[model samples]
Target: MSLELDINAAIKAAMLGKKEAELRALRAIKAAILLAKTAEGGNGELTEADESKLLQKLAKQRKDSLEIFRQQNREDLAVKEEEELAIIEQFLPQQMSEAELRTALTGIIAEVGASSPADMGKVMGVATKQLAGKTDGKAISAMVKELLK
Candidate 1:
């Protein structure tokens, strides 16, 4: 519940500071968490992995919206999505740099003996597990394809 505590603290601070944009993002996060907690089959306590996955999902949603908004010339909407994304990503682990991702994926490839695109599944399964919360899946996929080729 540390995430919840931190979020609540942030909500209070945001309320004090009267930052409307940030307050909106923080409330959205709190709502998502509460909904997750009460959803059917929810176990009430989310593990660190669960928290990371949830944050990643939220970030992904914002990114996708941001991309679409940009494409459609909806800068008005894109700005809000970008702001929300920034706030959501703040709670996630630091992303691996491209160089760092390459190094890590290279090591995983060797460990799994994945030498061709055919072995992408094997490498991805391991990489996704090992690199959870550190990087997005699409980035990992692109790098894996590059390294394999």
Candidate 2:
């Protein structure tokens, strides 16, 4: 199923199950889809790439909120953010392990012919395209930088 259709089904299932966090996440996903649709010059329907990007953004937002809440000693809020993150993550593809990511990055570095830190940009460009929806860009960038140096 398309990500949007899957999300709608999940929302229905969450409602029937009385899963509050999942319900909230479902609504957030719907809102993001609508926003993407209505954004100036945006296509009415999101491409798969667009949906993946949106989901990634949502995950990042939840993670950032969780960290901020923890920093402020708001355990309750942090817990809520963590719950939402879990729900959101259910829709994302399985993430790469650190070792897997390192292996992939090494291959990408070689493919891009990156020889030094000066070639970081070339390595990152190829890695991001290959690893999108599988790994976090920031993490990939850090790994590439470390390997290049």
Candidate 3:
């Protein structure tokens, strides 16, 4: 099933169950889908790739918020952000574990002939495309830096 449809179903379920946090997260996703559909230059349809990108963006925002809230010692806000992040993550593809990511990045490094940090741009160009939905960009970059060092 398409992510949009799944999100709509989840919204309905959340509403029926009176799950406020889940309902909030699902509504945010629904709003994003609507915006994407009507956005200039958009094709009025949500492809699987587009959905994945949208979900990743939302997840990243929530994660950033969570981190900031934690740093500021705002437990209340951080908890909300954490809950939203978890909800958003459910729509994303399974993330690659560190070991798995390392293995993949090692192969990519070889394929791109990236031998040192200087080759980061070359490796990143390919890695971003290859691992887009499978892992977070920050994690990928960190692992790439570690592996290339």
Candidate 4:
């Protein structure tokens, strides 16, 4: 996959630049890719969709860790996680802005005739499929609730 090439290039650049944060994130990504390739039942190669899903999973883990660090007042750990999160997120597709998400959700809501929260399931079934990779499910659901209300 082109992702492997881009990641290899990034790793070299980060090493040359001596960027600790970038180096750490890149190595994690590289390791994840390697593991994925070697995992049973997986092809030795990753598809574009598979790679994107992998990156998103890494980003989510970082975010969860970051939040816990913040809650426990672990600024040192939180800072490192934040840096990694930023680096990991760069590989994900650009996410929709709030206004854009709202507009898109509104259209979906109308399309599905979801005028009440009771109809959220109907809207979500379609919205999640259509908007996959564009935004987080939590963000989409929160916005949907607001719009429906």
Candidate 5:
């Protein structure tokens, strides 16, 4: 099913079950969808790639907030962000483990002829496109740097 449809169904289920945390996450997703549809250059709809990017962005935002809340010793707020992040993650593609990511990046570096750190830009361009839904940019960058060193 499409991301929008899946989110709407989840929203309905959350509402029926009176799941406040789940409902909050679902509503946030719905809002993000609407905003994406209306954004400049958006044709009032989202492609699969766009949907995946949106979900990743939301998950990352929640994670960042969770970190900040935890750092400030705000367990209550951190718990809420953690719940939302988990919910958002459920809709994302499975993240690659460190071993898997490293192996894949090795292949990518070779394919791109990235022999040194100077080739990071070239390698990152291809790696980000290939690894999009499977991993985030930070992990990709870190792995690429380590491999190139």
Candidate 6:
């Protein structure tokens, strides 16, 4: 199923199951889709790629918020954000593990002829394009840096 269709179905299931956190995340996903559909320059609807990008962006925001909440010692808010993140993540592809990410990045680095940190940009450009929606950019970049050094 397409991400949008799956999200809608999940929303219905969440509502039926009385899963509050899942329901809230699904509603947010729906709202994001609506906004994307109506946004200026948007094609009046979201393509699957656009939907994936939107979902990834939402998931990234939740992860960032979870970090901030933890840093602020707001355990309640942190837990809430973590719950939302988990719900959001269910729609994303299974993430690449650290070892898997490193292996992939190594291949990308070799493919891009990146021999040192100076070539980090070249490696990152290719890696991000290839890995988008499969892995987080920050994690990929960090691994690339570590491998290149």
Which candidate tops TM-score?
A: 3
Predicted candidate 6 versus true structure: per-residue lDDT over 3-103, tens digit per residue: 67888899889999999988888899889988998999878877777877888999999989999999999999988888888988888777899999989
Residue 83, candidate 2: Cα error in Å is 0.4
Q: What digit string (tens of lDDT, one per residue) describes model 1 on residues 1-149?
A: 48889899999998999978788888988888898888899988777778788889999999999999999999999999999999998888789999999999999999999999999999999999999999999999999999999
Q: Model 5 — which ten-residue stretch has the worst lDDT?
A: 85-94
Please give the range of 10 consecutive residues that has the lowest summed lDDT in model 3.
Answer: 78-87
lDDT (Cα) of model 2: 0.90
Best by lDDT: 5
Q: What would you estimate as the lDDT of candidate 4?
A: 0.91
TM-score (all chains, Cα) for each model:
0.95, 0.91, 0.97, 0.91, 0.95, 0.92
lDDT of each: 0.92, 0.90, 0.92, 0.91, 0.94, 0.88
Better of 3 and 6 by lDDT: 3
| Model 4 agreement with the true structure over 67-117: per-residue lDDT tens digits | 999999999999999999989988888889999999999899889888889
* Candidate 5 C-alpha lDDT tens digits along 1-149: 89999999999999999999999998999999999999998799899889999999999999899999999999999999999988999998889999999999999998989999999999999999999988989999999999999
Which ranges of candidate 5 are over 4 A from the true structure? Answer: none
In candidate 2, stretches whose alpha carbon ends up further than 4 angstroms from where it belongs are none
TM-score comparison, 1 vs 2, better candidate: 1
Tens digits of per-residue lDDT, candidate 2, 106-128, equal: 99888889999999989888888
**What 10-residue stretch in candidate 1 is worst by lDDT?**
43-52
